[model samples]
Target: MAVLNEEQEMLRDMAREWAVNESPVTEFRKVRASGEPEAFNRDAYATMAQMGWAGIIVPEAHGGSDFGYMSAGLVFEELGKTLTASPLLATTIAASAIALGGSEEQKARWLPKLASGEAIATLAVDEGAAHDPAAIETSVSGGKISGKKTFVHEAHGADLFVVAAKDGLYLVENGAGVTLTTRKLTDQRSHADVTFDGAAADKLAGGGDSLLDDVLDRARVLTAAEMLGMAQQVFDVTLEYLKQRVQFNQVLASFQALQHRMADLFADLAQMRSAVEAGLQAVDSGFGVARAATIAKAEANRVLHTISNQGIQLHGGIGMTDEYDVGFYLKRARVLEASWGSSSFLKDRYASLGGY
Candidate 1:
């Protein structure tokens, strides 16, 4: 685990409490059963905003504390443990696009609302089956954007969208001509296939072609934090199960083979933790951010896949059932593995950047 200062520790603890008490996996299961209209609980998200989680990385002048991305990562890591379904991740990334490249006027207009959680925001980057920003077919002409963007997280209830086009990023509000088609994922959360037809959009004041890469890099880092948390949860739960589950008149944990597998998982988890922390620090300090983010996301994808599968295998038949919460983490882990960028895709990107 990364060493956190007092404030970061407080943020993590508070998020942990909220995830346990207010938005546990059971809460998410209930939402899934109830077929809730929104992707996440609105009331709970408002409370998060009140706690300043949504604006953790925004500048104080824009209704934020300027706490930085590391603080945001700390909170997100906790939220990931329970698979808390809120717009916090998407919102933070959207807000950051503005902070990273938006002109002062754009920041003034959008930052405060985003910081307060008064606005729910998301990004629309993927245009095809693959998560390729370079494949963006979206076009901007005459101050109107027309294209289809898929894999749009939180689009079911997003108030704002920062859309990537061939030219640059554009702001498209939720209204006529901007249609959101929700595509349910394995995790029972809302992803979207959004189509914009002659929708009036404002080109992000200063955001250009490069802004997409910047935002995606930040999103990758935040998502890696979540994956790390999930990996930890799976490891902990599986380890506990091994201790209690008995076979051949001996606890599964007592088996030498199982212990060795767990030890390997522990080492992988440590590497994941280090990668994610380095990515956070790199983004926070604006140095080697792209390399750090790709490495983190790639390692997280690999580690999470190994751990989640191991968790299922070690838990025996019960791991495959819906009654088991461990299975839930596995489903979410699969979704997150392919999110933003897949493991293979990220590795290719890293290699292209001269990484061996």
Candidate 2:
């Protein structure tokens, strides 16, 4: 088992308390009703920024907290529990790209703003149904890029976009030949289908094929951490329901078959936790990050799907209704599973990396 140090534990507790006190289920319900994917509560985001979450992984020289990936993973897990909609993941992933591959000038310009939440950034990598980096259809010519990128998370609100084109990465300023067509995802977050027509872009210096692969591996692991939180939330909610919900003249928790199911779920959740923690450590240690990330994400994807479905099933008809909260977890799980890469995609990645 991976043990968090005192500082990391404090950070995790802080995020948990904030999510409970400020952005509870009631707040999430309100956000969903607003019909805007970028409709995250600004005050909550400000609070997170104040807590240094936005800069958790950024270097201290860049006005960031300079925490490691494990600490960042804890934050992501906490946010996942509430299905909180924010630019946190996008910003973290983009910042990682810059920190790992961006030139000194790029980091000096973008890192501070990202750490301070002054600018929202997102990665635009998917151009089609596949996750092949080499298959990127977007091409750059004369410092301009053109192509359509689909399923760009939080693109509608991002001030900058870290785009992958022609197997190379570049940063394109928002509205620089970039047009966003928003879509309402299952998770209630805003995903955009972005079209670029000769968009002016600044290429990140020294970002080769390996850099993209490295950053993508980090992204996958971070996503798995988030899914772990979601799965745990589902488990908690269902457990609570079982303890109180009565059927056949007794509480549902008294049934043997249902008890066994919950036990099985607990086992699965434990395995997922182990996988996620190992992946986070691997990312931090720079050891088998890609393969570990693939394993973590693939396992998380499977567990989240099972947990969400079971949560709904245990809740009976109320689970399917919009009035209930479990439906939200189900929806969010589906969206998270599809994001970055799907289970099959990650599995293939794991296989390509050789034995698990």
Candidate 3:
């Protein structure tokens, strides 16, 4: 586990408590059933905003607490436990782009709103079936962006878009030439496909392609944090069930074979936690961030595959049913496993980062 400061620990505890009491998996089920047309409830998102979660990484000058990436990851870890659907991660990731690539004036104009949750932002980076930042076909001409972006996270009610174009990252406001089409993900969450038909845009003023990579590295780290939380939650539930489930005149947990499997999962979970914490710290410390993020994400995806499957199998058919929340965790894990980068894709990138 990552060692947190007093304030970060407080934030982590607050987020965990909030997810358990206010927005458990059952609450997520209610949101899915209500057909609210948005990915998350507005009231809940507002509550997060009120809690200062929206600006976990933004500098204090810009209405943020100046807490680093690890702090944000702490809260996200809790949110993943409940499968909470909010723009918090998407917005915070977008905020990183502005922090690294936006000019002083741009930061002055946008960071405060993002930190306050008065505006929601998303990074429109994926342009095709493959998740490649270098594969951006989007073009920027005449101060406008024109292309289609798929797999846009937290786009249901986004206020701004930090877009990846052929030239580099650009800022496009929501209106006029921008069109949003919501897609229902397999996880019962909302993702958007955005069409930028000559949407007026301004080029990011600070950094270049490397900055885009930096923003993505941050996203990958946060994604790993969420996956770690998922793996832990499912493992806990499965462990409890095994202890209670009786078969063949003995408790399931007492079976040596099953016990060995869980013991292996526990070991894998520990490794995944180490990778996630390393990624978070590297991002905050600016040391080997790219490598750390890729390794963490790849390891997390592997751990999730093992833990989720073992979870369902150990539950003895009840895990496959909708009445059980473990199934929801599996569904959510599948989506996240593919998001940012899959285990295989990240493995390749990690090697390439080493000039292999």
How does each model score on TM-score? 0.97, 0.97, 0.98
Which regions of candidate 2 deviate over 4 angstroms? none
C-alpha positional error of residue 55 in candidate 1 after TM-score superposition, expressed in Å: 0.4
Q: Write the per-residue lDDT of candidate 2 for residues 23-127, one digit (tens) a residue.
A: 877888887788875857767777788789999889999989888899999999998898887888888999999988898899999999999888889999988
Stretches of model 1 off by over 4 angstroms after superposition: 207-209
Q: Of 1 and 2, which scores higher on lDDT?
A: 1
Sort the predicted structures by TM-score, highest score first.
3, 1, 2
lDDT of 2: 0.88
Would you list the C-alpha lDDT of every candidate in the order shown?
0.90, 0.88, 0.90
Against the correct fold, how does model 1 do in TM-score? 0.97
Model 3, residue 342: displacement in angstroms? 1.0
How many clashing pairs does model 1 include?
0
lDDT of 1 by residue, 110-130 (tens): 999999989989888998877
User: Which residue pairs in model 3 clash with each other?
Assistant: none
Error of 3 at 20 (Å): 0.7
